[model samples]
Target: MAEARSFLQRNRIHRALSRSNLLLGGDRELVLLTALAAAILIFVVLTVYSALLGISIWIGILGALRWMAKADPLMRQVYTRHINYRHHYAPTSSPWRRP
Candidate 1:
């Protein structure tokens, strides 16, 4: 797996070479700040909705369970795919002991 990964890294040499070019200057920093602000805005909206729904332990528990049920199948599929891929390429231990 490590050997295969090294080959993938070698294929990305051109992408690595372009990292030195700072074409955005301060605009890059502004872009990052804008993205963060957008995330905070969405989070605040969700929080406001949740608060309006109710401030209660029962509501929180139900919301959590609902989200888990909604997300579980997709999460399970992703996890299974990752496990199968890893097992297919995982390195086997050598019989000889190393110092």
Candidate 2:
């Protein structure tokens, strides 16, 4: 006789398993670094001007990052791979391209 499966027996994958894995609407490392930088500028700099600057920078950049993340969640990975590419690729026919 087959037994009915209970809800507790079912496997539940986390959000990380299915999603593009965003953190604070951008790359995890980038968001954390931005927070640290803003905190330092706002508090460690020890001036009202610096605090204002930090707040503005944080807001502006975070907004941009959110837009970017929405546009392409894998942008950071794509960019890093692109950085090693040569400036020019051979414009040869398929016949010439073969080793």
Candidate 3:
């Protein structure tokens, strides 16, 4: 059509598209790399958890590991070792200090 030809001539549209294509050439490779990394991470996690479940040790470890992962590892260790409900009725003492 005449309109199409005129628009192309005025804008040099084909040349612009080709230039843009050159600039955008690496987009596909980036997308492929991201997908590959995600897949690898997913596979590693699944394999480790499956192994843990098969051995039946994961249940004992899951609670402590999850809590430690959520908070500071040192603080979790301190809290678990020293906190006592039996002492609630007795005089309170600082867990960080010697009795």
Compare the candidates by lDDT and give the number of the best one. 2
lDDT (Cα, tens digit) per residue for candidate 1, span 1-99 = 555544343354577565422212322333345445555655576876644443353345445534644555244346669988985653647646463
Report how far residue 49 has shifted in candidate 2, in Å: 1.2
In candidate 1, position 61 carries an lDDT of 43
Error of 1 at 8 (Å): 38
Q: Model 3 over residues 14-53: C-alpha lDDT tens digits?
A: 7655532211222233334544555565556678764544
Cα-based TM-score, every candidate: 0.23, 0.69, 0.24
- Candidate 3, position 24, lDDT: 21
TM-score of 1: 0.23
| Candidate 1: stretches off by over 4 Å | 1-26, 47-99
Report backbone clashes per prediction. Answer: 0, 0, 0
What is the lDDT, from 0 to 100, of the residue 98 in candidate 2? 69
Select the stronger candidate by lDDT from 1 and 2: 2
Model 2 has an lDDT value of: 0.82
Over all chains combined, what TM-score does candidate 3 have?
0.24
lDDT score, residue 19, model 3? 38
Q: What is the lDDT of residue 15 in candidate 1?
A: 73
